[model samples]
Target: MLLPTRPCGPLLAAVLPCLASPLAAQSTDPGNSEPEPAGPTIVVTGALESRSLQSLDTPGLGLAVDADQIAAVNAINTEDVIRYAPGLVVRKRYIGDANATLSLRNMHTTQTPRALVSVDGFVIANFLGASFDTAPKWGVLAPGDIARAEIVYGPSSARYSGHALGGVLRLETEPVSRTAVSLGAQSFFQSYRYYETDEDLFGYALDARADLALGSGGISFAWRHFENEGQPQQWRTVAPGTPYAAQATIDDALGFPLRIAAQDSVVDAREDQFRLRANQELGGDWELRALAALLLDRDGTSEPKSFLTDGDGQPTFVGIAGVTLGRSRSAELLAGLGLKGHLGDWSLDLAVSRFETLDDRSRQSDPADLATGLIPQGGIVTDENARWTTIELTVERAIGPHRLALGASYAGYAGRSRTAPVSDWRTAAPGPVRNASGGKSELIGLFVEDAISLTPALEATLGLRYERWRAADGFLQNAGARVDYRGRTDAAWSPKVALAWRVSDTSELSASLAWATRFPTIGELYQASLIAYGPNVGEIDLGGFDPDLAPERGFDMQVTARQRLGTIDLTLSGYRQNVRDTLFGQTILVAGPGEVPVSQSLITNIGAVETWGVDFIVAAEDVVIEGLSFDGNISWIDARIEGNPLNPALEGNRFPRVPEWRANASLRYAVSDAFELAASVRHQSTPERNLENSASSRCDTFFCVSSFAFVDLKASVDFGPFALDLGVDNLLGERAFVFHPYPGRTFVAGLRWTGGRP
Candidate 1:
């Protein structure tokens, strides 16, 4: 995603004073007796919510990308929002699409995100684990539809299983009102003027929902579609007997000698989701809710590989013939029921859900093959399906000033994949050739959390969790034998402790320590593939299963401070983490007579490592102008591997992808009763690339990605029953390259029509 553009002289000068100002006197609006609850400070992806960021007792760091600010970042998808978060990194290899990857703390290589992603509390990730380039495509979801996104960076292994090793992210959709139908349409223009190429994108969405009263129960239903023809990127290629930059751009004004591979790349994403839920109070002490949801997300793209390139310092163009990377399809379904009630002094909550997913892959050798079958091709490369059923039960009881909660959960996953029959594009053969075995994994967990007030100014929290995980073998042998390579089952216990002290009504201090664990994934143990690029072809063999492999464990400690001085609010935090039995991917060499062949790396239990960091945030409301405000946060972090066979000096090395510093600021002003304006800026420093492999030249020195800064502008107008939003993304079109070279100078304008009876 694109970073905000650099701010102008005036905007930069106004940030400090705006953030340092005292809170404005409680507004004395003519119609209201009290201010609107100070605009509702929300705390998400954290436990034990506090009034301000610093006093938050959560053990891990938390970030919330406001919808307004998200628009300013000019991100095409969700990952764009956290691309600059303290310890977060986002990488897109060839337009990620559905397979883009996001990492936290530079752990992108081995650790499955440790980060969990959920849309409305429903988990979403490449079931194979978080590292398979399965991050949700941002182009599918509209920025205008997002209410807010919360990112928690760190291993929260206790609360979640599967891919939540690095941290967790929760994206909340805008809530639907009782009865309303909203419609909106938007479009934008983008181009690299120097390249003599231009593109235009347009889309529209419709949302309708209503709550009906059935006796004493409530029922609601809601639906959304999003589409765009994205701008193409520059391309560079190295061919046989040619230098890396054999053919560079003639003028190379940008200095990155590369040719525009495509005049245009098209992106089409459509999602049709429906949710129906009925909530009812059963008798006086029992309540029940039943919900059913069907979500179908279809994304397709046409990428013309190396269609244009440089030939001897001049531009050479290729045909739009058949050359596409990924032309795939995916679908998911979820349905569930929940029950909550109270008996005496105890409260109870229970829920059950079923989830399913299907992915389809296809390709054609020649453009004419689509109609003439020039190469006789017929078969699906791979198909994956996942079925999950989960049940969770929780009970909470209050004794005096103490609250205790107990919970138990069981989850089962069944996933299977197979290749459809196919023959060479020209030859003729039918029926499936290679069928991959499917597998299943199951987990059961029990947890308890308690909050107690030791004194008027002090509070404490204690939490514990016990979990067991198991997976069955699902691999096929080269000799046509079904391989039973399932690994062993394991169990672990995790715990967390926190203390909060209220030094005064306006300030507080808190500290917490937590221990967590994560199990290895099926793909890590049995992935097999063969990849080909031009004349180079190689086999990828995921190492054999290691039943003796231990679960990765982590210990984290954090301290935080929060205070409010008049109109200004500030937060500061420091943290340290120790990880053990870290599962790292290690490349091993196999002896070959005349050539060197690289196979799948082994997933071994690496020694250990430590990470330390600090976070800072300051915000103010109503600076010089009544409706103007500003907020920002800065971060500093250090992560390293203690000692390993690869490098002993790596102990204190900085984490590869964890940038040394990152921060953001925004200024929003209400121009008139029906109009408002906003501008924002975000910046990030470069980060080390790799820390584990030292023998290679890749890590000789910490190579930093150039620093980038960007700005955005938006205006909103409310005209009675309808509202209009006009905005510009990356106003300066700086091409900052936060994670990748995102779109430059895009424009967006939308109109929303809303009407209802209160």
Candidate 2:
């Protein structure tokens, strides 16, 4: 069924006429009226400002963070601006971690492909891998350049694709209003202490921006350079109390004895980013906007601990085994153009965007032994590239008391990934070609939505979307073997409906229901296989591809209420979703006589899953005392797998990475217009299972990690055009693990200078 089974026709029929009657009555009134006096003229001057759809009118729960809100917090990275957002989490490992991704609702942190991220309506989520390995390039925009960020929860809007099943993050950059220049700098330090590892890490960032006004248009340019030295969060596991730990020999890798039981992988990273934006006013209420961004990132080296010995004096470890050294470089470019205007009684908007990964290269080395100074026997080099192009057109019109919108979008992607052997790890010289894979995908969607005002205080929205997706040109090459994979195509029709009732001027209640389908990405469909060796399972080949993998389909329902009482605002929301053909990685044991057992991991379809959650948010401004405020939110979620064909015994297992309870709260006090102080707290319950839900793979106490809580404090001072800010994160030094142990207490300080607007 395209829509929910519930009947909404009667409700629409009763509301539409009630909303139109008042307007009709006003137009037909025949009473004689006196001449109206002319009011003072108001001139709006700026860089081509256009009115777009508002989130408050959308079908889902939406949250907005403006520049003032962003500046009130001590945010080093752009993603940090949304760190305390309700029902959301940013999986940031360290200051310079490139794989930072976002999770919302009941989605797991590793399900990066299920969410959508955009900057100025331009797609930024990497499609090269479609998993945790491919995250949005947050470095492209500096936190200072953001004017506002909007987070829309769920795929309840016809304007978005099914990829927004988890949610969507839309970032808008600062627009040039007048000629101005700004400069900013920041420094940070952290004391990190882990099992047998202790160190102090530091980082710094520099940024500058220039804006110019020309005629009826304006242009802006921004640049940033960032560098950081991060403590080791990853460790080489030896299984506590295992025989390998007892037999392992210690070696000096970081001027200290490094044992297999307690070793860390340290990282050094840097990034450079630049962006240009221009907007112009066309004749007859038309406007044009363009944007271009470039980002470059490099991880000089990720040094692992030394764990191998040559039995002599020199250590014989390198690459994947012992003290390994790895380097990676990546570059991305994003460009877009948009046009908006009016046609008769209809408003039209058109945009075209292109995003490309210009270069993505990595090299690693592992020497046999230092005695002979021989080249690494186990070294590899990888190269991957991806490009995406999207075109969207939307038109809106009003009919009687109802507003209608129609939109069409087309998106396509092309990607290539290859891995080759390295003859010399030091020089990164190519030895022999190993494997290569490439693929292409195309998506087209058409949607229409109507907002009907049934009454002055009641509104209803009905939307439907039709989408078609296809994958083709899939091929894999290994050694002298070449294989052409079969192409796949799928189509789906999604429907959404929403109702909003204004209980009073200060209260509102809303409910929404939607059905959406998400298709697989190029990486999930065509990426080459992976292999790993385990102590218990030797030579495990995990490169199984299911060409017939089905698309995931889901239904979502949500209800929310918002109320304002004096200076306090409260919001409560509840949601439930059910999905079919959910994709997940699972392990299959392969055993034979006289050979070690092998556990092959592969992506497979799980039959069904369900998730339900409740969230509440409370905020008060200037309550009790002037300039004192409180903002907080709490969430409770219950997610479980209902069916699994491969292993029915896994049914009813809790979804991985989904904490049952999560909460965040903050209190802020403004000593004056120039000074402010704030404190925040966050907590999360322990997870119930791993990604695969394997009982045998359970960790010591919990499934994978333990419950933890953290506290943060921040202070800021403004000196006219200059500003200073300080922050202490994890103030309590809470030792928490989410796959990787989080950083301990850290300190940050920043200074900024801004020129007055012309």
Candidate 3:
């Protein structure tokens, strides 16, 4: 599974040709071909320039946000491009957050691997592992470089891999149209307040990009520098004898006062990212694309502050947390190459990509006295390496009312992590591994899809996909003991069907049903943590990982109705998803002959979940005025665990972080030729943090999601090639939480210059 680096042409050539045998007729677009004598025309909304989305033929077509729409929002990072897209949300805690996770519908953020994110048809989402630490590589993109962003709903098309359970996020960069350079700068700040803490967190971003218009193609290079200081992500429960004054403490989810302590994830971070892309046309309706990106980050987590004082009323609180806390450095790389050709009535696409974690070293040291901080002591450094590669091929052709497509793809992952102690965490090196866990995974897929115009105003499409997945080269080590597990494989087939009808000139109704499977990642398969029982005590040893953990299987269905009325559009959608064999692992005491029992994690397939939701949207342009527009949406979702034999307490509890209600509204108006004003409002209901939905659900502390609403306002002024903007988020100072406190009353300002010679 450890395939060669990116641009692996020979490997791609050897693998992608599997679909060549079915090279026949399908068109990627319905607008490109003219309708027949009395055929009904189906107008798709938000279809971008080139149909890069494989699920275009599926019902409940995706939503799109263009440069103009993006300009109306106050975005902090690249993922913010789709922040307000219908049914989509990014768990971005603050500015410059690298671990921002994207959630879809009723799917919680914990299912990170189920969401597939791509840029220019190449996979950029981190598949090495499935957690917030392995979130999508959004840092590789600069916000100013994006031209359009779209989100396709569900895994209803054969054009996608199994990772498309939640959905797909697609982004495209601006085409290099001129030899020009652009510079952008933005600054933001927030007033944050919580128990025992009240302060301001701030950040800034700077970016520059240059594009070259080649004779027959184009090339572009971009660089971004960001620095930010965020509020503490965690706090220590304040009890008697803690560093802080217990009497002055405040309550949290766990029902206790809390104080900032060492290793609180109070991050002060800086990042530098660079990217280059080139696109060239090769006559005969063929084009080639290449992309390269690099990201570097240095994070500092300093000692926490204390409010305790001595007899003299001077600061005196000084203590050490039980965990190591210090600095970390990381670097990653992404590279991709793709070729597309238009062969008369058919189209062919081939691409290869690799996302590699080149170097990641985390150093942690024991905290010293606050006055004489950071004494050198025996510390630990965790080193990690990971990467994944993808190669894909697709052929599409259309003949009369029948359109068909065939696709083949291969994806592989390789990752390793080890931790050992060093003499000095700051600089010293050389140590033997005390613990380690690693493995490899691979998936190969082939699929076929056919869509036919069943009647004058009705269409039907059927798609089926076959996938083979395997994991090998897995090992977990503890102390001097080691265990190796390998050669585990599984296969599954996903089928999809969709029907759409154009009821009238201004209305359309559609329904879709799909079955999808999500395979366990290398991390999930390895289990990765080992515990031991003493042999001298006459106790048998229990293995660390459960190699037989089954894959997660799910069925998804949706129905949608869209109607256009005068200058307004109304849409209503309903969806349901059921999943089995959910990966819910737990550890408990196992009886042994000796006095001490053993506790080890058992990775098992032990749960079933069900989710259902409905959403309504309203949009309009020129509402009573020539330059006024409004867009609003509201949704309700229900997600709960159906059965859990091992933990029956959760048999009917709500899923973690799945809110029941959500809504968003935006209004834009043109004040003058050079000025525009836009405002937005967003809201969500409280989300439970625990599987059983018990004690933590009623609190709005560290482990809670608050039911809150906030407003945002932005004003932009443009003059020739220069633009200036000012905006405010949480305009009403709304207080909320999603584990970490959401920023409050934040103000943002930016300036950009685009019309300049390179």
Candidate 4:
């Protein structure tokens, strides 16, 4: 849960030249050659995998960061690794937010399924749905467990599936090396002040890890515990039926005057993570790797506060539609196994994984129930069975001038949930089912790619991926009335091309183009949305899902240039992508005369959109001074809707949540090998609330995204067997919003001690 706030340098993170140069590898290290290795290992330095661990060899622009850099970041969650990266944003509401959403370029924050996120080659991004409720499982990772993180932008790699349309991210964990044991702890405090609310929030984490020497290899076990309290996620306004407050009223996001009522929730969370990994070299260059992880989440909102006062200056909560004062707990498990080695003339790779939620249940109670103190009251929602499984087989061989690679992948998902009125909210016996749903989704993919050496200066790659997708066992129940949905299947072909030119020893150029098809997620295909997220938090009734909705299909293209100037590295990249049949949530109205012109919200194929962007990255060591180094990048994107017949008024409007300009930079000075000082700055322009680029974008108000600039500083000191960390985020104490108010200014301090290895 630690990462540098600075942008990962172009050299460490993006647009790097191919590894080993495909042309050179084809001739020098063909899989056809056999190597003899009969060595016994006591400590597993690492596994010898046929495939390269670095994914930056992919056609598109990519970025990377290592453990040394991660240790410098003042972060509390794994997702914060990319918070300040170029063309990236982690919609993290607070220090311990479980719904931290990640946005890649044009994908925006709410489109969670568009990105392919993996850890140690195991898929962690949730394809269950594209929203906060189904965010990637970052909490499953033990804090301080990652060694490196890399990301490839766009869907130009045939080795990956359409989820790469947004981007592909991979987190590499530390390999078990020698027998070692370590323990670490960190604590953080944030001072926050906003409209009608002010307070201080604090959190901390404890981590322990052990690496043991096993028979012929090594195994590692890690555990982490975290607890935190966050500010209220939202504030209510504009409700009738009563109590007037003493505080002054304020204008809302749309300039509407209203009194701030009770807050949504001030979350209190406790989480625990346990993970185990084992690696063994099976002789003959073959290796086996295995992983098992578990995560438990306990969150609740026990205190409900209402700003409004009754007739005698007493607090009242009668006007609110819902006031939750209950807790939710869930347990999740993830397991993976992989094998890679030589198979005759080809190098073969196999991977399999399963992620499941063993128990997921929530208890919610209306505030009125607290007054009555009934023995049995409130409601219980259960999602007892939800899981995903993935399997992959890949092989590669160098034949003549072509390096041929082929792979097949399968991913399956299933989920079921029920909501019922209970006797007791905490340990309830269900009375009658109020709402329920069950469904399944799956994808089967086959891909082939060939890297050819056109000449010494030129290299080309051609690739294609074919996918078959299906959805079944869909059902929705309301008040015991069940409705079943028909099953559906789809097939699509994605094609990709990439070219790289070694201009000279000082420079290089590359370009890539691809076509990808992204199918609908399970929730988007079956569930009817009741509460809206983002800026449009007002009450809405989205009636039903379109089971036959068209899949998102698009063309992505990019060009890049890189140059080395002494100790400095510079990279410029540009990209353009257009997605048709874009699956979006919007409103349409078609009321007849004499009927009320009410907008009907729907999640459907919302026509088409085109996006264009440019990024400039600069990384330099020993700038003007010997100890000074800098890493920075700037991005500009213009994403707009092309047309939408159903909501034509939105034509030519900016895409929601995509900022027009954003930049990240970090400067560091090493006083010595044991001491370092670093400073980082993050900035982003205000974004639109909806597809129409609504005029109601309030920059510094509740429920709105605002242009923000934050400065952070960190100082670290290392002793032989111990380390000390001191950092402050948002040094300027600037105010901003990402639907929920962003943290004001936070101070962090940590201490770690290690001793077993030396």
Per-candidate Cα lDDT values, in order, are 0.54, 0.71, 0.73, 0.75
- Quote the RMSD, in angstroms, for model 4: 6.7
| Candidate 2 stretches greater than 4 Å from native | 1-53, 238-262, 306-323, 367-378, 528-543, 589-598, 689-703
Stretches of model 3 off by over 4 angstroms after superposition? 1-55, 241-248, 256-265, 311-324, 367-376, 529-544, 585-603, 756-758
Collision pairs in model 2: 15-454, 318-366, 319-365, 319-366
lDDT of 3: 0.73
TM-score of 1: 0.78
lDDT by residue (tens digit), candidate 4, 307-403: 6666677766655445666888999999999898888888888989999998888887644533322222565655557899999888887776677
Instruction: Give per-candidate clash totals.
Output: 20, 4, 4, 6
Q: Worst ten-residue run, lDDT, model 2?
A: 40-49
The deviation in Å at residue 76 for candidate 4 is 1.6
TM-score on alpha carbons, each prediction: 0.78, 0.86, 0.89, 0.89
Q: What is the total number of backbone clashes in candidate 4? A: 6
Say which prediction, candidate 2 or candidate 4, comes out ahead on lDDT. Answer: 4
Q: What are the per-residue Cα lDDT tens digits for candidate 1 across 446-475?
A: 887766767765667788888898877556
lDDT of 4: 0.75
Give the winner by TM-score: 1 or 2.
Answer: 2
Candidate 4: 10-residue stretch with minimal lDDT? 39-48
Q: After superposition, how far is residue 325 of candidate 2 from its true place, in Å?
A: 1.2
